[model samples]
Target: MNEREKGGVPDDALIRMTLAGDDGAFGELVERYKGRAFAVAVGIVGDGDDALDVVQDSFIKAYYKLKEFRFGSNFYTWFYRLLVNQAIDRWRKSARSAEVPFDESWLAEDSSPPDGFAYPRTPENLARDRELGDALQRAVDALPEYHRAVIVLREVDGMAYDEIAKVLGCSVGTVMSRLHYARGKLRETLKSHREG
Candidate 1:
């Protein structure tokens, strides 16, 4: 049974239950958010295995800090900030260890078409799509950390600006500015690919 139907408990209630020593409540929360958390982490870190590690580490850190969480705050938002920070830390460490080049063949297969528009499945179109995807990934990887975070949270994770600001601990205006800059950089990068 779904956790909601199991006891009709909201996330805050679940957090309280977890804090009260109910590990099952926390497990339910983990089951609910793991995929989304992974998505956010993978978008930031660009590697599935590393992203998975980030999510696990983030959850462990969140568990330890649960007492410090303000009771009325949105649990996901608080948890998201932790997740993003942990993923960024993982990214920084990996960046120092090795600089792996972006490879389109290595990207996960679930990427959607830009703006929800579908491209034709002709062989030529498929090849072009692969090229575009590679170009996009390379461009995203080249972005600065703040800009990259804004792009991943907004475009990759479909987070609202205020929500991204909350995750990043920045003003909504900063989120907007960063997103704009990131998108502009992406367009410029892709445009070169198109011309060449």
Candidate 2:
């Protein structure tokens, strides 16, 4: 068994081990984050195949740039900067209006209505969920790239504002602004969908 797989080795330790010539330590990091990375990538790029390429490229770039990673800081935050940038670049290149799949489970998050209403297990409610999901997908796809990145990083990935600022290389206020704008746009789209 690899040293990283043995127990609760911290990310910093794995990074140090990787720097000391243990490739497997880096592999452990990849295994730890790849799923979330793929999800973020897909959210940004709006295509699974493009998201995969972005994730792979981001990992390769992160591997080569490991020497630049600052100690005493979160690795995932640094890595996500690269991942988000790659996804945005891919999205810009393609400019495709592909549908990004929305996870219905997110509806259960704190973003739910203030009334604490839950959709019951009825055919009508299920149909409404599907419609909502589709509207959300379209709304997300319509956001500008940076706004989309902010929404995906903040909402979908549940990242803190400061962490998102770090990843996006912007101020916390900027992150808040972008998030507000993105959320406003999404809310407008969804509201129109429901009312119509």
Candidate 3:
């Protein structure tokens, strides 16, 4: 068994060991964060393939810059910032290209809708539900980068405001303001659909 598992080492300790040449420590760190990191990436970039690339690129960048990480701060927050920034950068770079639409197939396979409204199995209900989901995704995709980042981190990833502030390199107030603005925009965009 790996020393990390045997010792129940903290992230900081694992990081220190990784920097000191114990490669398995870094693997442990990756194992611990991979799911959250991938989710953060997918939230920003919107495409599974692009999100996967962002996660890989972020990890590679983190590995090289581990020594520069501040010792006292949360490692996950620091890594989250890296992952978020990489995903945003990728999104910006691909802005001109045809965006690969956000895939919602996993939502059905993995669990019920976030709203928990189980639509009847009729074809019309299923079609309308799919349409609504697509519309919501488009509304989110339309948000400006800063607002989108805050919304995804807070709502999609269930990050606390302070945690998001840390990951976004901003104050909690900024995170709140951005989230409010993003939510307002989404409301405006989806209002007509709801009324109809």
Q: What are the C-alpha RMSDs, in order, of all predicted structures?
A: 3.6, 3.4, 2.9
Q: Kindly list the per-residue Cα lDDT of model 2 for residues 37-129, writing each as its tens digit.
A: 998999998888899999999999999999999999999999999999999999999947788665666565456565766555566876788
TM-score, per-candidate, Cα-based: 0.85, 0.88, 0.85
TM-score of 1: 0.85
Off by over 4 Å in 3: 1-3, 96-122
Per-model lDDT: 0.84, 0.90, 0.83
Cα lDDT tens digits, model 3, 10-73, are 9999999999999888888888888888877877787778888999999989999999998999
lDDT of 3 at 194: 86
Please give, for residues 1-196, the per-residue lDDT of candidate 1 as tens digits: 9756576688898898899999888988898889889878877787778888999999999999998999878889899999999988888888542222445554334765678786555768667867887788778878887898889888878889989999999999999999999999999999999999
Error of 2 at 78 (Å): 0.5
Alpha-carbon RMSD, candidate 2: 3.4
Model 3 lDDT at residue 44: 79
**Candidate 2 lDDT (Cα, 0 to 1):** 0.90
Candidate 3 TM-score to native: 0.85
